[model samples]
Target: MTTPLPVFAEPWPEGVTHRYLTHVGATVDVTGGGDRTGYRCTGCIYGSSGQYWHENVAHERAQAHAEKCLALPRPTQ
Candidate 1:
């Protein structure tokens, strides 16, 4: 069986604006533009509850989460 790739090893999806590397080596993908932006963590249940109206706001939240997140990537089947 092929081993699962780490979250950080995965390619960023379309429209991704930034990728924040978490403490445990996972990634938090930030997407959207203009008045709609959000982030989703690859290793944890942490993410923006909804899109932010400002890009900086989303980035700030994503960066904060990345700095403190310690969850490791889950194994994929």
Candidate 2:
């Protein structure tokens, strides 16, 4: 499997813009290894390329994002 791309902030190309995309659990058809199959995936890519953009292009943005994410509320059991 290919490693998923990391999110970062930078000046998006001319075509890129920020927006939120909804994600929900659903069955998806996928073909792989010469076989057609379906499976479930976790999480959702809700934001558009614009939403993924970062104010700072420097790699430091990763750390900032991490901290921000950590501050978010966690689900209660």
Candidate 3:
């Protein structure tokens, strides 16, 4: 039987506390607790090019990317 892939565990940068799981097991991490927030996807090269003044905007962006990103979780070594 094939072993299950390990969960992603990269340390979040300061202020980043939200992690949104994608459909393909990838992650979209959001940074908050400040005037500006942003998101970065672990499965694809897509990410926030600039800080978002609204937290909800960042969340929405993350969710949108998660819905379409089909990249599988990265391998852990």
Candidate 4:
């Protein structure tokens, strides 16, 4: 079985964006083996090389996005 890819290594690529795709409970048998413990990315691809993370890596991905997402409530300086 292939190892699930890491999603939060960095933010989504420029021109590309994503939203909460799924909240998987556990890995299904189709993946050979799985955890499904993390978030997945889905949405418009930025360019031809855009990527999608279906593996269980949501916690990291969400944290990364929050750090950059100014739309969310921010602390007063």
Please identify which of the two predictions, 1 or 4, would achieve the higher TM-score against the true structure: 1
For candidate 1, the per-residue lDDT at 5 reads 40
Worst 10 residues of 2 by lDDT: 25-34
Residue 14 lDDT, candidate 3, scale 0-100: 65
- Tens digit of lDDT per residue, candidate 3, span 1-77? 95475575767556677988887788888876455888888777778877564787788888888888989866555
Candidate 3: C-alpha RMSD to true structure equals 3.7
Clash count for each candidate, listed in order shown: 0, 5, 0, 1
Task: Rank all candidate structures by their TM-score, best first, as comma-separated numbers.
Answer: 1, 3, 4, 2
lDDT of each: 0.80, 0.25, 0.77, 0.31
lDDT of 4 by residue, 7-72 (tens): 544444333333332222111111111343333223211111223334344445544443343232
Candidate 1 residue-wise lDDT, 1-77, digit = tens = 95554455456778788999876678788989767988889798888767465788888888988889989965565
Against the true structure, candidate 2 reaches a TM-score of: 0.19
Instruction: Report the lDDT of model 1 for residue 52.
Output: 66
Candidate of highest TM-score: 1
| Clash number for candidate 2 | 5
Better of 3 and 4 by TM-score: 3
Q: List the residue pairs that clash in candidate 4.
A: 39-58
TM-score (all chains, Cα) for each model: 0.76, 0.19, 0.69, 0.24
Error of 4 at 29 (Å): 26
In model 1, how large is the Cα lDDT of residue 21? 82
Clashing residue pairs, backbone N/CA/C < 3 A, model 3: none
RMSD of every candidate to native, in Å, equals 5.5, 16.7, 3.7, 15.8
- Model 3 clash number: 0
